[model samples]
Target: AQSVTQLDSQVPVFEEAPVELRCNYSSSVSVYLFWYVQYPNQGLQLLLKYLSGSTLVKGINGFEAEFNKSQTSFHLRKPSVHISDTAEYFCAVHEGSQGNLIFGKGTKLSVKP
Candidate 1:
């Protein structure tokens, strides 16, 4: 069984500042990595994903992540964040094509102006 670990439960950043949310996973086989964000009172939305090919993948809202197979880590980063960026970010991995996904505890990104 695979599992994801989110290093931090919450991250605080000032508006227009860069931020990184750490994520790590453990699996015996290859898996698909993804980052999803959920704003207050909203459902989760895909932020980025690493299905295959490139290790570096980009996603909406200027968010990007690197898939480091060696380390089994996929960390999400935003060069500059806005107050509107405040949300809960989740790191998830899907094994095989079962459509069953294992998600991290989630990291709440607090962007203060």
Candidate 2:
């Protein structure tokens, strides 16, 4: 079984400041990782993904994540954030065989001016 854990439930940051949302996963077998962002009153959108090859993955809205195999971590980071960046971010892992994804509770990013 594969599971995801988001370290923080909420992250408050001022506009233009950097932010990092921590995500950790536990899996017995190899899996695919993904980060999804859900803005207010919107459906989940793919922020980034790590299917294979490169460890560093970049996504929309100036967000990027590094896949650390040894630590089982795939933390999302943004060099700077805007007020529009406020949203709920979810970490998910795909269990290869079933092609099902297990998601974390999510981390709310509140970008204030």
Candidate 3:
């Protein structure tokens, strides 16, 4: 089985400040990893994904994350964030054949201006 855990339930940062969102996962088999962002009253959008490649993966809006196999972690980072980046972030895994996602409770990012 595969499961994900997000360390922080919320992170409030000022505009243009650096931020890091912690995430960890456990799986007996191989799995696809993904991070999605959901703004208020809007659907989720793909932030970034780690299929199989270099440990470092970059996504839209200047966000990036590194996959650490030893720690079983995939932590998101941004050098600087904006007020518009405020949203709910979910760390997910797709280790099943049906392609259903197992999402973490969620990390709320509150970007203050």
Worst 10 residues of 3 by lDDT: 26-35
Q: Ten consecutive residues with minimal summed lDDT in candidate 1?
A: 93-102
Clashing pairs in 1: none
lDDT of each: 0.95, 0.95, 0.93
lDDT score of residue 91 within candidate 3: 94
- Model 1 per-residue lDDT tens digits across residues 1-113: 88999999999999999999999999878789999999999999999999899999999999999999999999999999999999999999996667988999999999998
Per-residue lDDT of 1-113 in model 2, one digit per residue for the tens?
A: 67899999999999999999999999867779999999999999999999899999999989999999999999999999999999999999987667788999999999999
Question: What TM-score would each prediction reach against the true structure?
Answer: 0.97, 0.96, 0.97
Candidates 2 and 3 compared: the better one by TM-score is: 3
Model 2 regions lying over 4 Å from their true place: none
TM-score of candidate 3 on Cα atoms, chains taken together: 0.97
Against the true structure, candidate 2 reaches a TM-score of: 0.96
lDDT (C-alpha) at residue 55 in model 1: 96
- On the 0 to 100 scale, the lDDT of residue 113 in model 2 is 100
